[model samples]
Target: MSFRAGFEETWRAVLTSRTLVSTMLLAVVLYAFYYPAPYAHETAQRVPVLVVDQEDSGLTREVLRDLAATRGVRIVDTVADMPSATARMRAGEADGIILLSRGVTRSLLTGAPGGGVGVWVKAAYLLRASAIGEGVSAALAGAAEHRLGSAARAFGLRTPVRVIQEPLFNTSAGYKDYVFPAVASVILQQTLLFGVATFFAGRREQGAPPMRRAAFFGAWAAMTLLGVFAGFFYFGFIFWLQDVPRGGNVPALLLTVPLFAAAVAALGLFLGGLFDRSERAMAVLVPTSVPLFFLTGSAWPLDQMPAWLAALAHLVPSTLAVHIFVPLNQMGARLSDVAGMTMLLAGEVLLYGALAGWLLTRRSDTNPR
Candidate 1:
């Protein structure tokens, strides 16, 4: 069998449509702000910080109170020592740490030097660490001034508590490494979904039948098999060759990419069949993305979103696929953890495929819109 001329023509027709080009332009404009960009909001809120009260002094307690009552800082939990704090931060538990040593208050009161407090943080997060340090230092400075006379507190202020931030996984504070891979997942879902949706919808409108539709779909699967792997392998090879982290298990992720794409393909076919008119379908499809990405934990953390909305997030295939691929691509999560996400894609494929087929039986040329 050779490449179908009709298939090429169908693709050319869809791709060349002036309306589709206009939609693409519109998409780019919308995504300018929708996609990750510069952070203008400097006032940080809910900044996670851990505390180690080794001193167990009144001064330490007062500092904790101020930290809790402060606007920018958020006290997540208390730890025992540097080792404990290091472990928690390593597991993505806390962003910064504050360790108060013994005699810190005594030094401030008597003007006698003592072992100082240590603030440990990931050096990669320099800006955030600095913000945390400033907040903590100001709070502690105020407390010290109240606890001791101005002269005695002045000595302690000159020799302030140390802040140590160790950048563990990513040492360079690269925003690209953190954000691009996740955005890539969004790209994968949108582009391929559009391709898949257009694939079947265009053919069905042209009067393709059981065998022809089957053949075209089979060819599409083959095409997606190549494209999905190409996208995954291309990124993986770049990471290996260019020193970007091959954050996920390369082979495992590569294996899953096609399945994820296939599920998305099925979803598009489902939508395509649901709306026979190409223009109408594209119109409905294009607008749906903004709300979908908003709900998919791309802009907001899943934990921060409302309970119902978070559950609604799981309804879309992109939600699970994004959860599995983005984190794996960025942070190198194991496949065992994302098995549920894969299953979520499978379930949606079944559901939407059934709905698309059912809707077709009821569709008619004169059917009311």
Candidate 2:
């Protein structure tokens, strides 16, 4: 068939195929709203904490007041002992407990490292624990600085230099902003892969004739277009809806999208050739989501992964896609900043596309029906 005719045929097939329609269109629309709902607030706020103040001094009161003033924490109760605070935590009334020892004020007055502030957090959810730890640390740091600055003034000495932190890229440092961009790259690859695999698997099971070179290219082109359409929805609509960071250079995104889509489409076709039935493709590919996502270095650094595993991960286009897309999409990176990953994705497009074509040709030769 001519490329035009084959392209028209493939579009008809995609329209009629339930798997392709659902994965390529329905899933993207539904998840665009659903996935980001949990992180709408960005970070948990005003976590309840109990304070055990054994010092019972003016200085301790001042410190406790400062702790309560922090936006991330709420001092729910001031208890005399650890047992009371433990009971509150057990009762679900508090997320953490802070114990200020008796010698705290005296030690500070003497300019010695005073009795420490003990922070106990519920580790069941690490995010909550982190917020609690950070809030407590900030409060204690403020108190220490106040005391030390006063001592320095009395001694006619200058205050020590303190570091000022300004978080860039992710100004709020929210989990949703940090994670969604990476997952978006994975979603683009997986959905396109699953849809193409299902379509090809069904075709093979029905004993479809081997495709001519033009026809194969036509089908690959149609799938790549669908993948690119999905990418538009992700960056244009979904990212805007969820308020995920987006300052991607238009040319950079336009440059990368087709290469990423084409590579995924070729990979899908290559995998699809191995399946005997429609369902088998899903069975083999669906479980790969978790492993592939982690392998992309979203959950862990590539440098930290075992050498063999890291090398194997780099072979998949999505690994490089995540690295490239996240920076461009979330961090507002230029094309030059991501030149290396762009080259890798372009290479995968060539390699996977050739491999897919070779597999189809080999299959036709073996059967020759």
Candidate 3:
């Protein structure tokens, strides 16, 4: 078959197959709304916290007032001792407990060594824990500065150094904004791989002949085109709808998408050649999704992973694509900034394309037409 004919045939097969349509096209649209639904609130707000005021001093009272005023935490209850605060937390009445130790006011005023503030948070929900920590820190800082200022005035002392924090890229520092952009690349790869693998594996199961070189190339092109469209749908429209952080270099994104798509499509075709049944493709590949997502290092640092495992992860298209797309789409990175990864992505296209072509063109007794 000619390249154009193979391309048209693949497109027809995709459109006509309900399974392929659902997996490739509709799933992308469905997940765009579904995955980000829980994150609609973005940042955690007014996390409930119980305060243990052992100091019971004027300084500790001022800090409690400031903590109650902050948007990130709410002082749901105050207890005279740590045991009561711990009980409230264990009972789920509050997300965390802040303990103001005895002599805290004296420590702040005299620069003494004994008193301190202790924060105990439920690690069950990391975002809530983080919110509570931030809220408490802000409140304590305000209280310390106020108390110290009065002391400084009496002694005619100089102002203490203050630390200013500004969040980069994700200004709000919300969970969704941090996670969704990285996951978008994984979604694009998995959905496209499912559709492409199912299509070829089904053909193999039907005892179809090995594709001619032109036809294999054409089929690969068709799948790549679908992947490109899916990438744009997530990066362009879905991001805007969900209000995830974006506005990266448009030209760099344009350059990166096709390379990433072609690599994934080629890799899918190569894997598809191994599966004689369509169901086998889904059975094997579905289990791999979570592992592949973690390999992207959005949730965990790659440096922390075993060196060999981290190196092996680069063989997957989504790993490199995540590194490229997240920065290009959200961090405003220039092409030069991601040039090394871009070149590696292009290399995967060549490596996988060659493997796929060789695999799909090899005739076998089971696939004989």
Q: What is the C-alpha lDDT of each candidate?
A: 0.65, 0.84, 0.89
TM-score of 1: 0.55
TM-score of each: 0.55, 0.90, 0.94
Q: What C-alpha lDDT, on a 0 to 100 scale, does residue 364 get in candidate 3?
A: 32
Evaluated against the true structure, the overall lDDT of model 1 is 0.65
* Candidate 3 lDDT score relative to the true structure: 0.89
Per residue, candidate 3 scores C-alpha lDDT tens digits across 1-369 of 778888999999999999999999999999888888888778789899888888788989899888888888998888878888888789989989999999888887887989999999999889999888888889889988887877787889976779998878997788889989988999999999998998899988997898878888889999999999999889998988888888668888888999999999999999998999999999999999899999999979889999999999899999999999998888888899899999999999999999999899876334522
Better of 1 and 2 by lDDT: 2
Question: What digit string (tens of lDDT, one per residue) describes model 2 on residues 158-231?
Answer: 98567678878877788888888888888889888998888888888998867777778888999898889999
List the candidate numbers ranked by lDDT, top first.
Answer: 3, 2, 1
Between prediction 1 and prediction 3, the one with superior lDDT is: 3
- Ranking of all candidate structures by their TM-score, best first: 3, 2, 1
Model 2: runs farther than 4 Å from truth? 83-93, 106-111, 150-162, 363-369
- Supply candidate 3's per-residue lDDT for 362: 74
lDDT (Cα, tens digit) per residue for candidate 1, span 1-369 = 223643454455545765543432344334434443453233355678899888898888988998888766789899888788889999998888888888888776766887577888778876678768867887787787666555546675544454567655554445544554556556556765665565556656777542333333554455355347545653565445434445666766775787676666667767776566665666677677677777778679888988998998887776777788765665667888788887777787677655654544343334411
